[model samples]
Target: MNKRLNSVMARVAAAGWLIAAMLSAETVTARAEAVVAPADGYGFSVGAPMTWMSRAEADGELDAAARTGASWLRVFIDWSRVEPMPGAYNWGYVDHWINGALARGIRVLGLIGYSPDWARAPGVYFTGPPTDPAVFASFVTTVVQRYGDRVANWEIWNEPNLPLFWGYLGDRAAGYTELLKAAYPAVKAVQPGSTVIAGGLSPAFAPDAPPTFVAEMYDRGAKGFFDAMAMHPYVFPHGLEADTLNGWSDVERVRQLMVANGDGDKKIWMTEMGAPTSAPTAEGVSQQEQAKQILDGLRRAAQTPYSGPAFIFSIRDSDTANQDNREDNFGALVTTDWQPKLAASALAR
Candidate 1:
């Protein structure tokens, strides 16, 4: 009787454990299902900034981008690159890319940020946050006034969360919010119907960065500032089908945060997402894997109900090609010869 009683207790404990595991899995499945519905309005569009293309080469590259089903193109209107001096501006170069893309029937997302030497922190790089928000806002006004007629969508910066871009290295979202607060109204003042998107936040470990940085932006009164939020959900070194529990799937996590903040009506753009196809590194995948990931990434974004336009990092690999450099190979869609990459062909279909 004692042996039988012990066996019954063990069975009961095992059943309880099994039931708990099943419930936990059901919760995860429900969360994943929440993001799988097709998004409205824009759905999914593929495109990248062909920034490195020569002025003469832009038309051809853009033509190729259209062939691959890219409906929108992204280009940087770098403040330092466009306004090298305090008062002077260079409109010819950027005009060429924007006009060429528009002529090809593709819309554009113009990224405008980065400080000129005059405005940057002394002895540091221009990618650093500017010393004055007024100076940065003035630059924003000038750019929008000139190109606002053509470029309806503008991204305030690239990746403010990373030290490489924001450059302050410590809690900088407050500073960025100030910049965005200044720029957003200035942008709307020029192009009332325009959509001003926050800079694409890269997945960084910093406190005031992606995942958490977004929440901070709202806390700092960033609600009415921009029309949409952007993020770079690059899941390199991992397959596209990798588990969502990992940081990469935090794109959905961000959506949850948006809903909680009463901004669920707004869309989240996956501004940059890709895996490099170079020699294996901490974040690099194989060439064949690159092709698969690109397609899978597109499908995932398209199915997510809150997602907007998704741009692959680039249209062509940088000219300085290196087998060992993963950054040089993120463009698995094209070869150095301008020929189609395995991923590019796959995306075309």
Candidate 2:
């Protein structure tokens, strides 16, 4: 009888432990699901000026972003500006943007790149790849440790496939892969829950298109280095469905490549997508067309199963007066004077 009682007690304890373990697993799954599903479906790029704006101006911009129903804001965590020298650092600008966005209930995707003069070789552009991946990784680790509590998503670089950004030397894909490999692990080590995104690939042709570049990254062992891939699919002067090379359609090809490489479970973030209303010559579109294309891109991204948040190129125009420079007019949601554009109304709907 004593032996039988002991056996029964042991079985009961085992059952209780098993039930608790099951509950723990379920809880983890629930949390993961919540993390993946963003509160707002899309985000907006507030441009590079967030670092320099006065608190009042930054608040106003963030208010405008929130009004558009954006739950995320893509801002640059520019290394050159933040850490101009080896040990010198500036957090004033970064703090204003990150805290302001959070105050408005918007999450931040911190795009980290641009080598400071000290970090790169002499005569190299600030946008050039760092002379040492470890140096860049150290900067990344420091940034993550500083803002990891508030900013969980980090992009390693921006448009590295382009010579203008990555410098005109070495293999672009190989060099970028090394940077990602270094930065991703550094970020993860500091904050295990952080999501390290590959630099947003620019829409280019031939040897530099997003699909081709992504494939090359994979070839250079880029897989598993990032939680998600990013693309700047700016199909300007063309509709979302237009059959043009290096257009929005390339996103699918990139996705297909990811799937083939057993990374289908990951997402592809449309980090920048928009058209300039006052673009140069044939590249410019009417305000109405800009609104339509942006809306269509947002809807398509939201509906796609493997897509991450789609961030419009800008929340407001950098300069509406600069009609010849397409870069200044990508802001379809708001004008520089704090006025809402047609796309803003459509987005609110």
Candidate 3:
């Protein structure tokens, strides 16, 4: 998540919203129910920018993704991008990516989230919670009605426990629970078999740690709303077994919390996990180290019966030139010029 790309997408989403509002007055239609099978293996995230890529570029990227033997692809079904205004939708962008992935034999874990300008809470950033949870639910309803047949897994939001993604407003866990409570039933109503994953909790400390935040969600009555818990246990420079706070080990705490809350049967899906290879910073790891950490994380998750499909953060570098920005270097499969990285071959095996 590059803020600059986010800003650019926000503007583009706003423009699409305006255009849809002007040209259409269509209301959401009910769709026949369908069963969506669960994902059986791990995959890579191509990120949100795929919605904006040229056909040749997007296909090339998906071609690379297919070569890695990925069974799933995590795509952002950004609410802001789809519906900028109430009852208005522009689905061309999302349709292309989702349909393309399906064609390539890849199932999609649609990460549906973010608020448009009209729906966002006043004075908060674009990532803020919506003014009304029902409005967000309605958006979820529309999404499921349209893409539920193809996209089986739906993640409620992106890292709601972190202020960077969810603005510092009211209680973060409570706010997120409201969205999940509203969305869970809506997705079920549209597609009863779909897997509604809780927002992937980011690795953080203090009140926002995975354990603490999950406890807060359960306390706020969030247990039954999701079929699985999602986490982004990115312990970059550190190995997957690192003992430090906010590292991959904390996921065990979250699982224990879930069992304590009487939801022990549910699995924890590692939706985003990867290490950047940028130099001169403690956070950066060597390309070989990056591959090793990611492979270890995936193997650990796979061996845990209570853990579901794990996805690497991205497929290719967003910008290799930005040596200082770690986010731009999380791509495990390729460099900015589409050259294969060490992790690409490692993952393919």
Candidate 4:
């Protein structure tokens, strides 16, 4: 249930940085027990792709993700894939994915989101939010129950703070709090001990940018909504604004709301965070620069309060132009295929 961010010196996979996690950094010994995961202790989780794991050479890729350091494994379990048809369920994908990670001695962080067509759209959760709360609830309950004992943490959604995710103008869709309202109890009732984490949030440059996600959730009465929380607090190189300075980029600005809602005791997790190895666009940070960005934030995550483990967004280059569905190259100092970048070696500490 509890993991010690026991390993300190994580190596840089290659030349760039997969910047994430947040801390003001003092000293980090190469492979030293992470100063971030709370002396109370939480282990670092290595992120990997489902498609990659299905490959014959997946073992080598998994090994590379853990090359620097990681105690748990992070994977996205999409609703769209898990239950492609309404009422019909499939555990084949999640089972295989988690089993593979476990075989490597890694724990699992299962993310749940992106409702299936049967669940409908323009409504309750992710891009195509569920129309019926009960339908979504059934999905969550089934998945959590199946992996209840195996996986301790389950995230509800991804990048839930934007118009594309939680923010919807048509009929004021995505009703942020409602998604949790339905999911929290459903997931917990099946696995009372499992941690129902908030959907990962996106931290933009302008402190008070578009959604004001935290404020909206709190206003909608999001008190006691989750166990450990999460954020995507990704700021541009060397940029920190008040709203973007919670503990990490994803959970940005939400900590205060948690406190306001009388849930300060709950911890914060960075489900998605990383600096790309290369700029998918001309304005973005380079892949090499991303490696450094990751080190900066990760040090902070290990050292700060309300801070937990900061998992890099990706293990390899996913797409080009991270923005606009571009690849953004948010690896932890290496290319997606295990090519070593500058920061990769640095992070490998």
Q: Which predicted model would earn the best TM-score?
A: 3
Task: Name the 10 consecutive residues with the lowest summed lDDT in model 1.
Answer: 29-38
Off by over 4 Å in 2: 1-40, 243-245, 279-282
- Write model 4 residue lDDT over 1-349, tens digit each, in one string: 1111211112232222333211213212322332234333223333335633443334444555555556656777878877889767776657776786777677788888777776776444446567776777788888887888789788887766655664352422136578888999998788878888885776554433323666666677666777877776565544343323343533534666677778888888766656554534433565445654555567666666777666766665554434543343555534544454444454453
**Order the candidates by TM-score, highest first — what do you get?**
3, 2, 1, 4
Considering lDDT, which of the candidate structures 1 and 3 is the better prediction for this target?
3
Error of 2 at 80 (Å): 0.5
TM-score-wise, the better of 1 and 2 is: 2
For candidate 1, write residues 280-344 as lDDT tens digits: 75356765576666666667777777788877776666542586787777764455555455555
**Candidate 3 residue runs with Cα over 4 Å from true position:** 1-39, 243-245
Ranking by lDDT: 3, 2, 1, 4
**Candidate 2 root-mean-square deviation in Å:** 16.5
lDDT of 1: 0.69
- Candidate 1 lands at a TM-score of 0.82
Instruction: Count clashing residue pairs in model 4.
Output: 63
Tell me the lDDT of model 4 at 47: 37
Error of 4 at 192 (Å): 1.0
Candidate 4, residue 349: Cα displacement in angstroms equals 5.7
